[model samples]
Target: MLRVFQECPELKLSSHGRKMAKFGRATPEIEGLVVASGLSPLIMCSLDTGDRRLMSTFVEYWHKETSRFHLPVGEVTITLDDVTSLLHLPIIGVLHSFELLHVDDVVDMLVELLEVSIAEARVEKIQCHGSYVRLSWLHDVYQMKI
Candidate 1:
């Protein structure tokens, strides 16, 4: 699973979407990788969790029914090197706010989710705005540039 996800990090990997595609099986591998990597909880969150619809094939099927309001959504930009650079170092950070709705808000929720994931993963930056959400996270500092 880790191998495949590592190879194709962008593959939609929502187990709730449907029967796992032959190639989709890699989705679960992320959990094992998180454990093996011994990364911080934030990093683990990034590897283990993702937007349900991000993993689903049908765009319409992806929606955050649990969100109370238009979730505070944002795009985050981060670098693997920036994070991995802190190996064995204690992590300190906070969660970014998300404002995306659950129903009929697939793209909005995904963007918000990605932002949260970035924060949990110790991302250093975020800029989710405009037509395309732009979020960036780096290591060393939690410098959110939204």
Candidate 2:
């Protein structure tokens, strides 16, 4: 399962002289909160335009039924430890799950979590096209709270 596939050919990637778009980073005001949540490592990460050819090769070799990479040498799949090590995220913690079956439930969740008025929650739900609000709006709310 851990053997390397030497039969695979080397990948060639081309960027076509195109530059990747830059994304906004977290504000300094949110630094403390991000650190407290154990996500500060993500802030230090850099972005790059990825290799499409390599990604295509991986996709070509992927076996959805087995949920593993069917390489020449062996089957490969990512584990929770791989995610923990690569992303520096906590693996052992209470898992939170919730389900909202209706718009009223979504409105109630928004009101309870954001501490906004029921009318405001309903407006946000409508503006966001049901059951979801924009992250920017949530950021604004957080800013207002702090």
Candidate 3:
């Protein structure tokens, strides 16, 4: 995932605060909270823009097995083993810490992520607001149109 972000020429590390984004680094306590709240860990990636502002986007949690898998199915605990297994889960909303980024750059970065880090995920749909972008990824699909 880091390698994919590194390939983007437009992506640079933020200089002021926490310089880089961390992936799958949720501590045990944090994971426990997320599991209890039925909240999946949404993978967030950030980059520094030309103007020295931070640009970030939310990508589906391709590796959120810990929290998402242990959900209760009626009386039984069911594990979602497939990457696209969470299609039935409702996306409550988009969580944005700062202003959303442009659609094109977000799209490009997601494509790179799919191509590099997660080779099995598929982009099912892309919803673009004026500032924010939301994407849905399905089960394994070899070729991506984008």
Candidate 4:
């Protein structure tokens, strides 16, 4: 099994650092809003880079067909309950469906949400190269606002 894993192709892990770690703690005002939004647990949760060897072993055991880990003991699958338990996040909530919006719409949203000028919003959109903006950018904007 160890030899098989060693022979297998290396999994391409993301190079991006942990977003949550950089997020830090929210201000008193923002903390209230976060709690009201039922995302307080996420704020409380601390993140750390886990054992890559263990992760690689798990990846090797993962069966794509059934989406279960074919461990020597038995098959196992991570459930929503597991996520809730591990992360202390609320599983029950209104499901948010994200739809890709036009660049103009994204600009409009940024302007309205961040209270930035249209020109500023457009510049941010151009910098991001799409509708998706960096959380760090958002945080900076939010800090400026406060």
Candidate 5:
């Protein structure tokens, strides 16, 4: 019943690689805090269909040992944030693209995507040229070519 919208990188920080200790700890107290803060929007938004079931489900999702969230639509991941935080790096955004790739080409495509994502200062138009990939945004371009 889990829809994967994003995938987590196979990287581990501690023995409990799947578990996000900080977020897991924070999940339990989020509801109470949001409620006590008089944030009706937060509560209402989470409580879609006027039922608390969805909100509880989201909270449960957050409490999972893994950093993936499975909602009715698709999965959401914290892998980017996790990776960036681990490296003490700052991130402005994340960009990912998926297509029906041939089995033999998927890994190569993924690597290319990651390279393009990292090289570009900002994400915009992503174009592929033979063995090279290009990413453009407004007028700024990255130093990496291909």
Candidate 6:
């Protein structure tokens, strides 16, 4: 089943202590509580560029994943094998039990998925807000006659 769901307030990383506009979606907030225990909703970011700020949120560890290896399923004990398979990439980073290289593989993955060079998309105006690097055109199928 291809379930397409988004958290109404997907992520509440407080950048520069600004309030997040509620996304106005139907779904409830994604309460990643256990790991994100003490983290404030506003991130208060001092990063200069928008892309960096946006990417930083993903790179940093969220509260929910801390202090335990909790997964959606009932049983707890999760292995790097599990995360690696889900992400479809070999696990790399502090695996706690094994050694591997390329700790920031996820950053590369995000950049590729967005199809933009993080180096180039880093701009001043987009500071904090970040860049919407993709563009699409939708031509009128036919003009409606009034």
User: Whose lDDT is greatest here?
Assistant: 4
TM-score per prediction, in order, is 0.15, 0.51, 0.21, 0.68, 0.18, 0.20
The digit string of per-residue lDDT tens for model 3 on 1-146 reads 14233233453543421321312244455456656654453333233356432232211222245443221232223354432354344344564365566655555544554342322212222333343323223112222322
lDDT of 4: 0.76
Q: How accurate is candidate 1 locally (lDDT)?
A: 0.36
Which stretches of model 3 miss by more than 4 angstroms?
1-96, 116-136, 140-146
Candidate 2, pairs of clashing residues: none
Tens digits of per-residue lDDT for model 6 on 49-138? 556555544433233546343234433544669645543444545434423424244335334443335553343214324322222100
lDDT of each: 0.36, 0.68, 0.37, 0.76, 0.40, 0.34
lDDT-better candidate, 1 vs 4: 4
Q: Where is model 6 poorest over a 10-residue stretch in terms of lDDT? A: 137-146
Clashing residue pair totals per candidate (backbone < 3 A):
29, 0, 0, 0, 0, 10
Candidate 1 vs candidate 3: the TM-score winner is 3
Off by over 4 Å in 1: 1-90, 107-146
Best by TM-score: 4
Query: Model 1 — TM-score against the truth?
Result: 0.15
lDDT digits (tens) for residues 1-146 of candidate 1: 12122232445643322221212222234446655545434432223455664443333322346322221253233345555454443344554465754332534433354344533332222243322333222211123422
**lDDT (Cα, 0-100) at 6 in candidate 2:** 51
Candidate 5 wrongly placed segments (more than 4 Å): 1-55, 81-146
TM-score of 5: 0.18
What lDDT tens digits, residue by residue, belong to model 5 across residues 1-146?
65543454442222322222222222234446644544423222221144455544565566366667865667888775874555444444455354555433533443453343433412222344233323222112222321
TM-score of 4: 0.68
